[model samples]
Target: MSHDNKTAAYFGARDLPDVIDYVGEFGAELVTFLPFVYWLYRAGQLGDRKVSTYRGMRPLYFFLSDDQLIEKDEPRRFVGYQKRTDPSIWGFIPNPNELIATRNAYEAFPNYRKQFQSTRFSFDKPLLVVHNKFNREWNSDTPVNFFSIDQLEQMFSRLKGYYQIVYLRHGRSGSVDGYSPDHNSLIDFDETSVMQRHPEVIDFEQHHREYGGGVAINQYKNELYAACHHFISVQGGGAHQCALFSGSLLLILHKRGPEAVHAYSNGFYQYATNPAPVCMIAFNDRQLQDGLGAFTDASLCQGRVMLGANGSRIANDLAPSRVQRKGQPVFGTDRTPEPGDVGVHF
Candidate 1:
């Protein structure tokens, strides 16, 4: 939690510590668990360089070696991906503390800042961010877009009531319903009876299916937090920071295997009795939304804003231009996390 002189800093690296103590340093607690499947896709995308570093575990000297010379060494493709970079811009070296502060500061901007209006916090509130690490099924070759009908149903049903939900679709839009241009919102993922059931949910697709849809979604949340409540997500890290800084309660929903259900549940929910009003919502149920109400109920009882001023700090420090560019490759293609890498396996 303390980054005295011993800590080394760099630019363009994503190897922040798994657990970040935000209380003393920033008054919030944020944790990150590596997503094994996501790492594999990222690694596989890097192709040949896949063997060098595991999920950005070690410092990526390649950026320093090339000095933004990514375009010159066009790497091979893994499922239509090629590693390339833009030299004009300097990549960021992420320090856990710096990133946290950066995220906090970023969210503090006027055009964007919110959540600090006194109405968001309760007397004894503990904002907790759970970092859920999940593993990938090595043999199962299912594209991110194509979730089994059962999986799709569970995913949607499990995320109810939570204010903000983020799903990282690593390209390849060939799933239960092929990635169609018009399909963007969660409702788009639902088909037949599922779609019919949520008739009132507006389909924010036409504008959301662009090149940097995810980035746009985050940006949108930055503005939306002024009025909304909490931001909950399965994907942790920066997204979680965004939520916390926005003055919304950070609900970390981790994905553990079915067998790990008891562990996951206890790990999160047990924190409810802590001095701070922080709560963890862990689940093995494919239907993640099942526990949405619990999170909302906890947030209400705690009377805490979902995000805070620190989130605004991050919004500023790590501006989109400073981090990885949209539609560009940051690492090699090897989506699976390597041996020493930390990740969640559910």
Candidate 2:
């Protein structure tokens, strides 16, 4: 049988209807199912179609909701299949077999960056959404592929002047619906210590406490993300969310996963957005530093540089300029630097 037929057979054996794709994880929902549904909706194929997803995920499907396109939005119940177990069963369109051979979602789907742009919220400075995850996955004792407190401190110290950084690390309590810490294994990080050290950086958990009312947390997140054009995230759902915004630059510190393979080889990193956000993936601390430097340089250069996966300059359109002297103090210090004091060279 063909790969598509085999995929159908696999879902059938699990008693899942062929028309209904099941994805329990938020990352897979963004990278696979959501785009597929959007394609179906755009093609006039979702007249009576329905989507089964976790409860709080409705906001991510706001485009469909706005149009009332799908017939039903059922709650997801099946946890039998995970992308790690079988990528083929993760979504209806762009079957893994074909996706591995040709990454066409970048061209095939709607411009989600444009679709999700928000007019509700505005920031005084350029917004930088930083997402970190700490959980026991792959049976490791502590969290894997997560940003350490030191790394975050370095990131905040470097970019705080040019951007309003919002830190996000979901905890056991006060999590929104469909994203309870119970659903995913949770480990504690020293968020309080980090906040104490860097008082200028906004804590998203606290922001949600103050401003997140009535609406689902995912909806609130969507609004906040829509206003931002730059993001720093670790691997998993947060990185996937950042990847969906277009005309943006996302630096992802991913140590391992099937995503790493797809990103380096199959070009799956570019599949989420239409114009395709600049995605730089770092495999280790050294690469993370290099990627962070590229981001810093981009800001200093007035967003003229776009770095690729290996920290190599992939696109540069304008001539380099000397660092601006009149901006906020360099690196959040009280003293402002003289001309050429800040490094603008990549």
Candidate 3:
């Protein structure tokens, strides 16, 4: 820590989502004349001080929006990353007790809650995204975050003509209620199958190049999400990222109750500062059954959709009334409502 004047000390790494969160902090730095700001880079994702690695940091400086960077000094540093605690510039850190967290560490940062998105990736076809997150066998303590392949297929069948059900493949696997994503089956996405590509799916690198490049992978990922019309996923990281960056309507399924979700501060707005519309579907009992709950502010309830598990109508039936109210569309009426595709905060 004593010798190198060039290398800056970045705190968070290992987790890709959190790392991207740190990258978002760079925006606050760019707008201000703070001389120099600490750049966060994961352990192997950077280079030695002697060698200025242009490739890794190039995309960031190139693609960042005017609002993303806080007015600060201009110097690139490759600080190391770790997985213990995340600290935002303004100090809005997460409660140490929760095991799973999003950009909560960067919550206090100025641009921390803002969504950095690009529209170049959106398709002309109606888009629907499914971000499945199931717990691995060893990690069964948490509830399942994925849907059965058959369930997904059913969803596709209903939405095929109206919407393209896009499945996200991060080369992951897990089980739920004796069911898991199948490698042999054409529908599942595993490490091996991930390489085999699909016509309907959107891959990050390929799409980025199509849009004229010059951006980091995380920025590209946000671009991919930004292009979509709606996102449906269990309550987890994918849902969190989608809410923050994708600009898609969120349709989330959460198993945890209001008490636990409240205690953990799992609202989507805590992470996504975007003033976009949001609506969450809770699967817990004893909650308000038919009423709606808005994330961020209650007045921004135009497209505010919320329904309890037991007595609520299916998302489709409620879309018209839930998504639009008093002649106003939540995020505009450019896209149609695909139930199971809603929004979140936290």
**Tens-digit lDDT track of model 3 for 67-88:** 3333222322312122213343
lDDT of 2 by residue, 186-282 (tens): 7766667777888999887778768777666777787787777788888777786776676677777766544443342244456555556666666
- Candidate 3 regions exceeding 4 Å error are 1-119, 134-138, 141-143, 172-216, 255-260, 263-266, 282-346
Of the candidates numbered 2 and 3, which has the greater TM-score value?
2
Ten consecutive residues with minimal summed lDDT in candidate 3? 291-300
Q: For candidate 2, which ten residues in a row score worst on lDDT?
A: 316-325
Best by TM-score: 2
CA RMSD of all predictions? 15.8, 11.8, 14.5
**lDDT tens per residue, model 1, 46-150:** 222222211212121122223211221122111201111111111111222221222211111221233223232122323322222221232343222133345
Q: Runs in model 1 with CA error above 4 Å?
A: 1-193, 206-218, 236-242, 256-279, 286-290, 295-346
For candidate 2, report its TM-score: 0.73
What range of 10 consecutive residues in model 1 has the weakest lDDT sum? 80-89
Best by lDDT: 2
